[model samples]
Target: MLFEDKYEIIRKIGSGSTSDVFLVRDRKLKKRWAAKIIGIYSGGGTDCRVKQDAAREIQILTQLDTPGAVKIIDVFEDSRRICILTDYIHGISLLAYIHKYGPVFEQTAAKWLLQLCGTLDYLHNMMPPVIFCDLKPENIMLKDDGKLTLIDFGAAYQQHSDVSPGIWKGTIGYAAPELCHGTAVPDIRADIYGLGVLGYFLISGLEPKQVEKLKDYSGHRIVSRKLDRILSGCLSENPGKRYKNCEHMAVRLRQFLRKADF
Candidate 1:
């Protein structure tokens, strides 16, 4: 508070490999915020990797500036640390909801998937195009009003070329086949693949490993040949086989819906 911003800590909410997230309250404006603090050094030497990650995340979030994504409130960076303050999501993460309520109904999953499509579309359409390398269920927060917000941009990268070996990586089951190999620069299709995994999880409570073993959706409440076909396209090992863009996926998903509303 002496040299940095004016936010009082409420509690420590979450943490990641590079940062510690805290629930904080803005002193002047009296608003709630989530502050992610990353130490600039380890063992008395500057941790350039950590610092770059923290700085890049801040840059990405600032550029995003959209309603579907979490909004940034303030930031404080110094020789010792970098603190990023963002609007507190104040909602249950999709992963937590799934653990508590089990799988959702078919239409419910479709609705959320549609929302996700729009969000990803926004990201992929950015100037350099932002690719969310870590887009598992935990990073998606579900608000009380049924809206979904994408959170955590630590593993996100600008999509101009394939990622260099040590730049960024992703979750195993949720990440695409090419992404895990550390060569191919991931594209929007990678997020599409993740979206497919999420939709499967929401409708059938299946993980990626389980999805690979599945052929039919008979046992699950969400039974449809069209859905099976669509998900299969999304999970394709070859990115070229996936939907050209999120809009196409959203259109196909809407067609599979039993009701006209979407």
Candidate 2:
């Protein structure tokens, strides 16, 4: 209900299947925060599994120390609900920013994706290896300082062992083909696919799925032919045909920057 025994709920920012996100402020601390509350599921609302899942998500978020990753400040549970307190990222999300400014400058776009890739690298290489199941632009925030912060760990999962089956959950447009089959488990590469899809959107302003059906992208102003090739490669139908990994993709993206004198 109350945070740090001071901040009160101002209003709800967003809500999902199992939780409600509120924008709160602490007068004593003189800071803003995003608070996520989890409670019992009524009509497929919340349940024990969701509570346990929220706990796991908090644990994963707490381990992050990267700049572009959203910081988790505190976690607590009361008789009424499970609560997670996180820094209120100031500024709009990447999706909103892009919508307002058409496509971001190529250099700025590279900077954003690089920051995200750095965070993804950190996440994928954790001791137990953590996979950010969801990696869409909506989940990526752009701070006032021109830095990108990754948010929403509701779909995040830990890699138990090398042989463990991959999780099959992610947003449809961003989800990899294997996840769609619900048989083959996804891996870190799946995140790459999502990033690839993001790259496609940045260069072409068209989603990967839409690109497949369309004939050409030459009409796009900001993106050049060479850049389009790279985007297409990243969005390859077969994951195997795409970049080897985030590190590899980052390397190639850097090459693009260098060519552009970035």
Candidate 3:
């Protein structure tokens, strides 16, 4: 389907279970944007839960106004689908970058992790606290300016002490063990666990089977013991053993960067 008269669809960029993303250009503004079309209905009838999820995503996107996050441009809804337009990041996914360039340098990885930590801290400190359950490499885009932007808020949830535990919605390898067990309530620590996995991936170009089983980086001459300790702390199986919050983890990462002269 076509968007407004001003926007022209260029090509399909990505697709998921609920949405299809297209690279669209605005003739009037001469700018490119990512248009996500979310199907809200099935053959039988409208899917109320999907509709609510789309609305919730829009609400969360509107509240976010940070360089670390993708900015929402416009949102449109028709009888069949909901369309969300956002900035088209002019770069490749972190996953692609890693595949092309091999594992990132320690300094570069530290810089990116610091940025991610700050971004997570911002989300965790929001009014109701936003938990970004999905933080895998695919969801991270690296721009030409050397900045990283987090995308896809479909699995994000507002932290509410009153709310009961819900179904876990996150990437398998990157997801926290607590999420898989369904025994503990998810919170900011879940995101911390994701960050730890991301760090391990960036440094070693290998995905750990589980956060708790993260390989000892000391054996790798390139990995610093201090950095490994930080990653291990974040990857703790028990949430209580991890950093109290994203801010705390960010602080620790910054300290490591400074010590390493990054």
Candidate 4:
């Protein structure tokens, strides 16, 4: 219930299947931060796998130190729970933003995608290469300063070999087909697929289910030819057919932005 003597819990901000996140404040510095409290299990209460996942999330967050990604400030564990403190971002989730304001403009979507692509590139190029298995509107935060932040590392993994087999660990609609089917091993391309889905959702206000039914974005009048090509490639059913990597996609997106009159 109680965190470190210095941090005071304000309120619960969010909760997931395995953890609950809270808005906490440091008494010493008088600064706010988000703390994720993950329940620890010993013998039978919760699944052992869930505990491993929480530990893994803590490990990965501790390793990552990029501005685009949420920074982990402190980590502690007690007999019953594991607590992780990170910078408190002030703003709304991309999902809430879209629901409130409707689909974003093509130009605005392009800019957001560029920022996300750069972040993904950094993750995929890390020492062991972090694969952000989960990428969706809810996982992205639009800060008040007009920048984006990627949060929720519960599904992230460090790719050790060509294909690491594991259970599917992403949202249904936003996850890549390979990940959903559990037939193929997911790699960096999986994240590319997610980025494509995200772009479509932002520009068209269409969920992944609707997006998947359409053959292409040609039907969407707002989608420019260059943007359409990029989205199509990124959402390819086959991972191999998607963009080579996030960096490759970022380069293309930047080029598109340069030529786009909007």
TM-score of each: 0.91, 0.86, 0.91, 0.91
- Candidate 3 yields a Cα-based lDDT of 0.84
Every model's Cα RMSD, please? 2.4, 3.0, 2.5, 2.6
Task: Count clashes in each candidate, considering only residues at least 3 apart in sequence or on different chains.
Answer: 1, 1, 0, 0
Clashing residue pairs, candidate 4?
none
Worst 10 residues of 1 by lDDT: 214-223
Stretch of 10 with least lDDT, candidate 4: 212-221
lDDT of 1 by residue, 141-239 (tens): 999888999888888888874357545657888988888876577789889888888888887777767875455556543535667677777888889
User: Which 10 consecutive positions of candidate 3 have the poorest summed lDDT?
Assistant: 210-219
Error of 2 at 136 (Å): 1.1
Q: How many backbone clashes does candidate 1 have?
A: 1
Predicted candidate 4 versus true structure: per-residue lDDT over 50-168, tens digit per residue: 67777778888988878899999988877678888998999999999999999887778889999998898999988888889888898899999999999899888878743445475
Writing each residue's lDDT as its tens digit, candidate 3 over 164-197 gives 4656567888878888777766699999999988
Instruction: Give the Å error, residue 211, model 4.
Output: 0.9
> How much lDDT does each candidate structure score?
0.82, 0.73, 0.84, 0.84
Worst 10 residues of 2 by lDDT: 161-170
Q: What is the lDDT for 91 in model 2?
A: 83
